[model samples]
Target: MGVYCSKKEVVEAQSSSFIYQRNRTTSLEEQIKARCPNSSANFEDENSHSTKHSSEGKMKCTKVCFICHERVRLDHSCTNQMVKDLEKHMDKDQLMDILMKIKQQVSKDEQSLVPYLHWGTNVALIFNPFTQGLQRTELARNIPEFSRTILARENRIFCIGGQDSSTMKSLPTIFEVDIEEHYRIKDKMNMNQARFHHTAVYDQKYDFIFVIGGMTSNSMGNQFKMLSSCEFYRVQQNEWSIMPNLKVARDTCAACLFDSQWVYVFGGRVQFEKRQLTNVIERAFFSRIDVSQWEEITLQGRQRIMPEFNVGMCHQVNDTELVIFGGKDTYNKQTREVLYFDTSSFSLIHRKSQAQSRKSSNVDEQLSQAKTLQKNYSTAQITVKDFRMPLEIEAPTSPFQIANNLFVLGWSKETNGIHLLRLSLINLNWKEELDFTSYLASDVD
Candidate 1:
């Protein structure tokens, strides 16, 4: 009787295993039919359709379970038939809990994939001043308007605030170029006000571009008016905010960033009935990464007017000195005079001529002209002397400093082309860096 009981138990166990295997196979077949409705119609039809989709490169056999909504890739290697059986036994609450966990994991993964500004190997070498060579890459696109303000940050160049070609009016539109990515052009956020003849300076430490005084025609129908209000743009945030009003309304001024602490604006013109010019020097101080206040620097003794009408360039020579060049005087005459300002004393300390050469026979004549020029500003404390500039630099534009070298772009009257003039801070000598007329002409065409 004991032997008979043991044999009966073995037979019962084998039968139970066979029933479990049959149930699992049935559950898997049901799952496949539910997920792929086309397969429920006919197996041969489903196989042909899948073959056609695969030929078209559109076959996606993966399906989401109705119970848990989890995607499962279906293929011949699928050996987990028990998963379908287990899902059939699961309650709705258990399935919902599994889905919630899966959603949370997906959210975390997406958050971790947020892109950041890449800083490695993205520095652009547009032109080499020391080698007098260009990289031979085209601008991302044609500038929307002429006389726009250009500012550089990281591996990008931004062109902002110029006259619109269609309306012949000032534009607030901004454009950017990524130098590392084949110089791809992209439009960026617009400024609060449409401006032209404005100045832009980038702060590397904080990644801010401050747009200073310029002329805008928004208020007066066709006439451009000077603006004292300023604005700064945060690059990372892609937002713009108004800064404190400048101490004086100015336009067509020469501006420079000094020691990362102050932005000096010098020599701009205000037009009313007649054009009024100023030689005022004012500074906007950066406090806690934002412009806090502005202070006007008084020039002791006499005030010698600098340049106006977008004619001058300001290059910071050191922590305490700035060199200014090529601006129109009060007489509306373009002068090739170089002026040095002492920031410590807030004074114009030196004045010199920017002539390439002076013949021995013409020395007395040059001296006489220098004396005449000095007499025009007899009250100013300036030492007038003859200093030479490179012959290729003509109609000099604003000067920008990069890596201790000052660069000035201008048109060469002799070559009938555009030239880039570079001044090395170490040697304080000017040299022709590159000629960009042919390259620029091709782009314009």
Candidate 2:
């Protein structure tokens, strides 16, 4: 265990539970003094102490991570400090050089390979495969589980808390899975604010995953009223803390990253004094400076005069652009519409979706591509995947069909099936199903 200090002890005006171990024999206090130099250092500065590495190819690396403030050698982690460099000062060419150099280093390293199992007929259904890691699920085998929503960081996938078969709330616990391992949940993580339709966003700049407002009343585990409050999890720190609540108590707001400085969250349902809820985009902001808290954005990003019909389940494509898809519009799930927003232009793009094709056929070549991607280019090719036109599939539908828009998912009551579904996006398509290349159920929380 490490001793605690006020936020002052660490830079960024935040106190962290971890301290660097300089010398095996040295105490924590001395180690801090040695590495941090003067106690009054600007811990948040990116260039506090940097290095230029001349590799065997003699290419110099200008980017560096000052271990004194935030440690970078632990894993393939980029702290808030590192993100600052790329976002603010690093030129495009320099960024490419650095990325290429780093990629080379990574490709040279050796790591274990995770095997995938065929748990079900489709990727959506929970792979009940036996495990070699953390062994447990929210409910017994009688209930079905699927990767309903995944908030992916650099290499980690936070399977946002989902529903189970019974009236009971989903395990109320979120699962953190690594993409390298068929996306196995690292450990069981609980959300104080019981969430269903809420959105979890990974802000690489902030190094935090912000979990925003969602509907809670109908959720079985949510004994509390519906929540408009917000919470955040610091990825590097592996901890969750509550921030300021959203302006409205809502479940199913559309959340998008805005200007890379704030999360533009809006348009969901809010409950009344009588437990009655109305659809409204609870406009608000969640920033890295104080991500745990939220502030309202009053610029009226809502396209709806009445928020009820406004879309929810949004795929926050970027800091400035978000794709709004299907959600409860007055009565049932809206499947006919697709909306896009450009925060820079403050323009909304709406289009009618066509009934797209499913996976055309189980081509051996396609399966080979999946295997090759897992082996050689999983990390190198970090592709953008939003709701896309349905992937063509000739396979028979087994309790599920591809979605027309950003198919925000919900858990099924049955245990044995109904896991995966396809969706239609702008020009391209990609499967949002579980990674069979490297996952197992026991490897989950």
Residue-by-residue lDDT tens digits, candidate 2, 303-359: 434335433445544234555554445553343244555656555544222112224
lDDT of 1 by residue, 1-445 (tens): 0001111122232233334443454443343343332332332232332332233222222222333444322332122343445458874346445545554444322111101111111222345442345554445344544344344444456767766655668878776766556767778899998887677776655777888887777543377788897888887777888888888887767787776778888887776447677777788888445687778887763445443434466767654677776556666655556676777777674334332244435545544544343332111212223233464333323455543356777655567666666665422446676666666433322
Error of 1 at 71 (Å): 62
Give lDDT: candidate 1, residue 128: 44
lDDT of each: 0.54, 0.40
TM-score of each: 0.59, 0.46
Q: What is the number of residue pairs that collide in model 2?
A: 31
Off by over 4 Å in 2: 1-148, 163-167, 170-172, 179-185, 215-224, 271-279, 282-287, 292-311, 316-320, 345-445
Each candidate's number of clashing pairs is 0, 31
Query: For this target, which candidate reaches the highest lDDT against the unseen true structure?
Result: 1
